[model samples]
Target: MTTPAQTPRSQDLDRIESELIAFLEGRTRASWDEDVDLFATGGLSSMFAMELVVHLEQTYGVSIRGGDLKLDNFRTVRTMADLVRKLTADKDTDG
Candidate 1:
């Protein structure tokens, strides 16, 4: 059973994972696990990261700038989901 706090997080993770998988469907052949390192595998390139950043920013309506723009944040599906959640939470708090 999920608590109220855990429910949103789980839903967010599921949504983010689905979106990431959809984006990567044709770009790579390998099936991606949430925690797997996207960079370590040949699944993504530096150039592709920019595209992903754009996708995330546009999709989530979150501005990922400054210190938030780190390669580590985009290293894997789970990390990317966490980054989105953080950015969204920050935006909610600020606005």
Candidate 2:
């Protein structure tokens, strides 16, 4: 649950997406396309995937639980940002 102060807005989500995209670019083999499949693009690896989950949890203040840890949820910077937004919204709802 989050207070109003903890809730993320549209600009904040955009900022998070931008930061995440840059983070992936630093770790990947090549530049990224927003819709590119991260796994296929070498943007993420199984060994390092959990690090992303941790980063999302710490950065967005949301928990990634059983059903939320799917590969599809992390397919791109857009998707990852969407996931964080969704999870954060869920927290707002639960609040």
Candidate 3:
């Protein structure tokens, strides 16, 4: 069974995927696979990546810094969602 926190986290991930796919679709005029490597596919720009960092930090209320600021972590929408889950859990436990 999903806990209360798990429920919102799952929903947030779905929302994140939706938002990202919408951005990609608007920019590339093509459907995006959830698991496709965004960097490899040239689907993301440096500006967009930074925008994603800001969006994740603000939307998830979790800071992205230090060792967590890795490009590999943002390879795909699913991976970014995973990072959000991890950072959010870390914040919860720390406080």
Candidate number with greatest TM-score: 1
Model 2 TM-score, all chains together:
0.79
Give per-residue CA lDDT, model 1, range 1-95, as digits (tens). 87565687788888988888877775675688888888998778999999999999999999999988898998999899899999999999997
Of 1 and 2, the candidate ranking higher by TM-score = 1
Q: What does candidate 1 score on TM?
A: 0.86
Ranking, lDDT, top scorer first? 1, 3, 2
lDDT of 3 by residue, 1-95 (tens): 87565687788788878877786788678788779999999888889898889978987788999888899888998888888888888888998
lDDT of 2 by residue, 1-95 (tens): 87555444767677878888787778664677667888886768887789989988998899999999999998888888888888988998998
lDDT of 2 at 57: 95
* Candidate with the greatest lDDT versus the true structure: 1
Q: Specify the poorest-scoring 10-residue window by lDDT in model 1.
A: 21-30
Model 2: CA > 4 A from native: 1-10
Q: Candidate 1: where are CA atoms >4 Å away?
A: 1-6
